[model samples]
Target chain A: AQRVTQPEKLLSVFKGAPVELKCNYSYSGSPELFWYVQYSRQRLQLLLRHISRESIKGFTADLNKGETSFHLKKPFAQEEDSAMYYCALFNDYKLSFGAGTTVTVRA
Target chain B: NAGVTQTPKFRVLKTGQSMTLLCAQDMNHEYMYWYRQDPGMGLRLIHYSVGEGTTAKGEVPDGYNVSRLKKQNFLLGLESAAPSQTSVYFCASSSPGTSKNNEQFFGPGTRLTVL
Candidate 1:
């Protein structure tokens, strides 16, 4: 079985400040990691995928195979970034998701 | 195109009652999934289908039953509604078996309440 964990339930930061949401996973085989974000009243959407190795909306995540972590980071926070984020792992044909982290970027 | 649409955006059901949630995707993707979202539990897969007429159990499929009679439709049924089953349900689809990365597109979601 595979599991994903998002340690922080809520993370708050001021505008222009850096923010990081921690995620860790436990899988026996190779893993594919992804970050998903859901804004207020909006449907959940993909933020970034580790395979792409590209940043979206100034957010990036590095897959640390050694540590089994894929943490999402943004250099500067914006009020519009406040929303719920989820970390997920794809194994075989199923995707396992973390509990999710809510980010609040205050002005 | 309407990416993925779930019928009955919002529903209220009483305990012991039964209801079925319908999910349709226009992308003609081969893979479809049903998931439930709660406050802190994120999204838990309730059931999934790889192709038409085939259904498989997912992470949380105990109280749920599913059917995939058509290639673009997946239905989730609750035999006896329970308060614990009240949550937001989301339908997602991906063009798997062809795409390597397999990015899933989700629907707006259906909020189900059991009283």
Candidate 2:
């Protein structure tokens, strides 16, 4: 079975401060990781994927195979960044998601 | 394009009742999925379809049934609703080997409450 864990359920950070959301996965083989964001009551949107190696909305995540982790980070937090974020792992044409972290960026 | 769309933005059901959720995508994606979002558990896949007329069970499929009769549509059915079955259902679609990088496009979600 594949599993994704997001240890922190809630994360609060002040504007302009650096914020990081930790994600860890348990999979025996090479893995594909993705970060998805849900803003307020809106639909979930793709933030970024490990294979893309690109940053979206000033946020970036690096996949660490040694640690089996994919942590999302941003240098400066904006109020607009407040949302629910989920880390997902793809295996056999299916995506397994973490419990998710709710970020609150206070001004 | 509308991307993905789901019917019944919100619903309330009684125990033992039955209902079906409709999902439609305009992106011509080859894969469509149904997932239920619960508090603290994130999103769990209920069922998925890789192509028209092909359906498969996902991680949590015990209480749900799915059909992919058409290429652009997928339907999820709950034969007998239970209190524990209440959740926000989300529909997503993705097409591989495209510029999308297999990114799934999601619907707004359907919030269901069982009484």
Candidate 3:
């Protein structure tokens, strides 16, 4: 079975501080990892995908096959970055999501 | 384009009552999905459709039913509502392949409460 686990239920950081949200997965095959974000009053949307190897909104996540980890990181937190983040693994044409981490960037 | 839209942005139902949530996508995607979001649970797939007239059960399809009679719309039905069913429902659509990164475009979500 494919499973995604996000260790932190909530994370808080002061503005301009670096933040990292941990994600780990259990899957036998090569994993396709992605980070989805949902802001207040907004719909859930893709923030970044490991295959893209790109950053969005100052956030980036590197897929580590050895550790089976895909942690999201940002150099500096911003108030606008506060939202619910979900780490998902895609397999068999479906996505298995983590419990999610709520990020709060305090000004 | 409306992208993806779900009917009844908010709904309240009593236990044992039945209701249906409708989702429509104008992006002409071949895949549609229904999911429920709850605190600490993130989002769980309730059901999905690969194309018109084809529906499949997902991770948490126990109490929910889905139909894809039309290519552009997918409907989720609950035979009997329960308090545990209270959660925000989301509808999403995506293309079949990885050309679009398999990104699912989501609706604003339907907030359902069963009291």
Leading candidate by lDDT: 2
* lDDT of prediction 3: 0.94
Clashes of each: 0, 0, 0
**Per-residue lDDT for B1-115 in model 3, tens only?**
8899999999999999999999999988999999999999989999999899999999999999999999999999999999999999999999965678578899999999999
> What RMSD, rounded to one decimal, does every model reach?
1.0, 0.7, 0.8
Q: Write the per-residue lDDT of candidate 1 for residues B1-115, one digit (tens) a residue.
A: 9999999999999999999999999988999999999998999999999899999999899889999999999999999999999999999988876654578889999999999
lDDT of 2 at B62: 91
DockQ of each: 0.85, 0.87, 0.86
lDDT (Cα, 0-100) at A30 in candidate 3: 88
Please provide, for model 2 over A1-107, each residue's C-alpha lDDT reduced to its tens digit, 9 standing for 90 to 100.
88999999999999999999999999999999999999998999999999999999999999999999999999999999999999999887788999999999999
TM-score of every model? Answer: 0.98, 0.99, 0.98
**Full-model lDDT for every candidate:** 0.94, 0.95, 0.94
DockQ winner between candidates 1 and 3: 3
Model 3 CAPRI rating: high
Question: Candidate 1: TM-score?
Answer: 0.98
Model 2 segments more than 4 A misplaced: none
